[model samples]
Target chain A: MFKKVLVANRGEIAVRIIRACRDLGLKTAAVFSEADRQSLHAALADEGVCLAGFKPADTYLNMDKILRAARETGAQAIHPGYGYLAENEKFAARCREEGFVFIGPSPENIRLAGNKLMAREMAAAAGVPVIPGSARGVVSRDEALAIAAETGYPVMIKASAGGGGRGMRICSGPEELKEEFSIARAEAAAAFGNDTLYIERYLQNPRHIEFQILGDSSGRVVHLGDRECSVQRRYQKLLEEAPSPALDGVLREKMGAAALKVAQSMNYFNAGTVEFILDEKKNFYFMEINSRIQVEHPVTEMVTGIDLVKEQIRLSAGECLDYDFSSVPGRGWAIECRINAEDPENSFLPSPGTVERYRPPGGFGVRLDTHVYQGYSIPPYYDSLLAKLIAWGPDRKSAISVMSRALREFVIEPVKTTIPLHRRMLADKSFADGDYDTGFVRKFIPVDEDED
Target chain B: MAESPKRLEIRAPIAGVFYRRPSPEDPPYVEVGDTVKKKQVLCLLETMKVFQKIKSPADGKVVEIVARNEDPVADGGLLMVLETD
Candidate 1:
């Protein structure tokens, strides 16, 4: 086992990794930006290094500074706790070249998974179900039109390098396709510096379900079952739950096997998620792969009782998975609500300020993962995620009830938060019944101006 | 008597740690009573390991320094006061 590891990220995820490292008897080194001088992650780690600046480019994203800090601290490995350089192939390669273990999948796997088109191709090659559309980039309007005709109407024109709903257009017909092709091309060029666009048949109201897979360097892999992340706003998941209410035992097994195949195909190691879009008719299609430990990983951890961060570090250290996959059936249902510092009533604008009053919920079956406390100043330089509240119960209904109660009991004052919206969502009949989709939040959450 | 020289406040454009020199070993970029030209690099703001040059927006004499070396500053935080000629 490594004696020390550097956490090359910040916020709650950094704290999560540091705690896991400590549990495994390893010292942790944390890097912080100028804005995060008093951050909880810095305080918790055995050693903390300040990157000196507040901007992301100068702090968390500065590879040289992070590597230098790791060297200075004599850290044997670097755990990029999602976002930032977690999925950055270059950073991973650099860590290895610098003789520091990169606690994730091989850089090659990250490169393949980072490209949407290549990942789709790999899925198809692996015999996994993928959305039918262009096999490659559509360079001309005629090519796009032909692809659209074959895939049927209501196709999505997506940038080859696009994400977060940028550089994309949905065309319902030939006229719309002709009009949108140039616009998408231009947008893709501006956003990603590449005009490459691809076409796909857009599935309506698809539930975003993903499987958490863990693999070791020896090629042994296991699936931690599925997480239903359909509760989203503009593709950003607000809530995630394990043992998806949409899947039965048979369907769950099938999806789990498919997820395993996806990981096996790439010889992927460490923790990664295989995301799929499940349609209304129960047909599932490969969406993309997130080649890092995700923000919503706690829900899976809650149900599986597996510490994913610890597993990532162990796998990187050449340890084989000790548990049998067939015996590790996920117990109970778990739900996670990402409490962000955003004012839902004001179009969800980020509200960064001091948390004058902070009272987190507690009880059996409830867990709070956060890096904030009373008087902790929320900096405007990074993500607005304040905390993650996860609740587990014997069943989905009990889990929902516990989560609703926990949300009500939680209090973060002065700066506005998404607690109100989460409270309203938990009370909605559709959400309570587990019959909500990605668009459910937008349609159901009332934008009451008076609430602000 | 000529109108009192217009006093201007030099504020940080971004939130970060303010540094008085390019590196710790270097002398301070400018001291009080030093005359500076427009766009001259006055100090450095370090964040995320990147050092950004904080320049003088106008020709001025450094009247007072509100922020000391290695001070954490927020956006628009006062760094110094300058008297324009």
Candidate 2:
């Protein structure tokens, strides 16, 4: 076990890694920006270092500063908890080069799976189900139009680099495609410095399903079931659940095997998520792979009873496959609602403010991994996510019931939240029957102020 | 009691601290009665250590600043309401 590990991320993930390390009798070093000086993650770590000012690039993304902090703190390993540089191949390579282990997939795996375009080709070659699209970048308007016709009218023009809806444009026709294509290309370049674009036949009302796969250093891989993350806004997931109410036993084994195949194909190690888009017909297509620990990982942990962070640490420390695919039988159902600081009344606009009152739910099967406190002001520079409320039960119905109860109990006054949306979703008939698609949020829960 | 819409609220794009002037010694961009344009830099929102400038979205006269200098601003927190023509 490493004497000390440096957390290369912030917020709840950082706090999560620190706690996991403490459980394993390993000391933790937290790296924070100037804005996070008083954050709980920093306070809880055995030692914390200020990497730079508040911006992500200067602080969390600064390779030099992170390495310096790691060296300064004598941390032998670096754990990146999703987002930021979690899936950055360059950072992972740098960590390996600098003699500090990165507690995620190797740079090679990230380079292959992290690139949306590259991953699509790889998955196709592996005979994994993939959404029919162009084989390469769509450079011209004519080429895009031709591909659109063949792929069908509602083709999506997406920037081949970033995924969080910034570089994505949904085109129902040619005119919309022309206007959306250029804008998506420009935004993609600005967001990821990549100007390449691609075309994919957009599945109408697709369900976002992902598989959690883990591997050891000695080339052993296993899949930990699947998560339904269809509930989303702006392409980012807001709610997630395990043992998808949509997919059955046969589909689970099929998707799980496909996910493991992709990881093994890319030589992926540690923890990674293989995201797939399941159409309303139960036909799942490979979307992209997140080469890091995901935000909704708690739901999976609840179902499998697997300590993923600890496993990542162990794998990085040259541990072999301790358990194969059937090590842990994930029973029951788990649900998680990401409580973000966004107003459900104002079209879900980001709501940053000081919390005058903070009371989280406490009971059976309810867990909240958060940093914000009553009086702790929500910083305006970071993601609006404040915490995650996860619940586990013997079945999906019980999980939903527990979640609805916990949400009604959890409170953060003054600033508005997406709690109202979650509340509505839990009670919605479509959600209860698992008949809704990704458009569930935008369709039923109108984000507009007037509708509210 | 709402006053004659003289408020120019410079909302933060992300969550962070609110910095008044470019530097402590430098003069602040707008005083209580300074006339400003749409692109006039009013204040800086310091988030995650990134200093994002909050510009005037409308041409107006700076009426009053609601948030205190160096205080934190939420996503929709009103910075300074300006009275526009």
Model 2: how far residue A339 lies from native, Å: 0.8
Q: Write the per-residue lDDT of candidate 1 for residues B1-85, one digit (tens) a residue.
A: 7777999999986566788987666799999999999988889875433356888999999999999798777767899999996
Question: Can you write out model 2's per-residue Cα lDDT over A1-452, one digit (the tens) per residue?
Answer: 67899998888888889999999999999998887888889999999998767667688888899999999999999998888888889999999999998999999888877578888888888889888889998898888989998989888888888665656778999999888877877777777889889999988778999999898877888888899999987677889999788898888889888998888888779898999989877899899988888999999899998888888998999887677557788788999999988776666666666789999897998989998777887766677788999998899899999999999998998888888788988998989998777888886555554331
lDDT of model 1, residue A83 = 85
Instruction: Judge candidate 1 at residue A184 and give its lDDT.
Output: 91
Docking quality tier of model 1: incorrect
lDDT string for model 1 (A324-352, tens) is 45778889999999999877776565666
| Total clashing pairs in model 1 | 8
TM-score per candidate:
0.84, 0.87
Question: How close is chain A of candidate 2 to the true chain A, as a TM-score?
Answer: 0.96
Give the TM-score (vs. native) of candidate 2: 0.87
Tell me how far candidate 1 lies from the true structure as C-alpha RMSD in angstroms.
7.4
Report, in order, each candidate's fnat: 0.00, 0.54
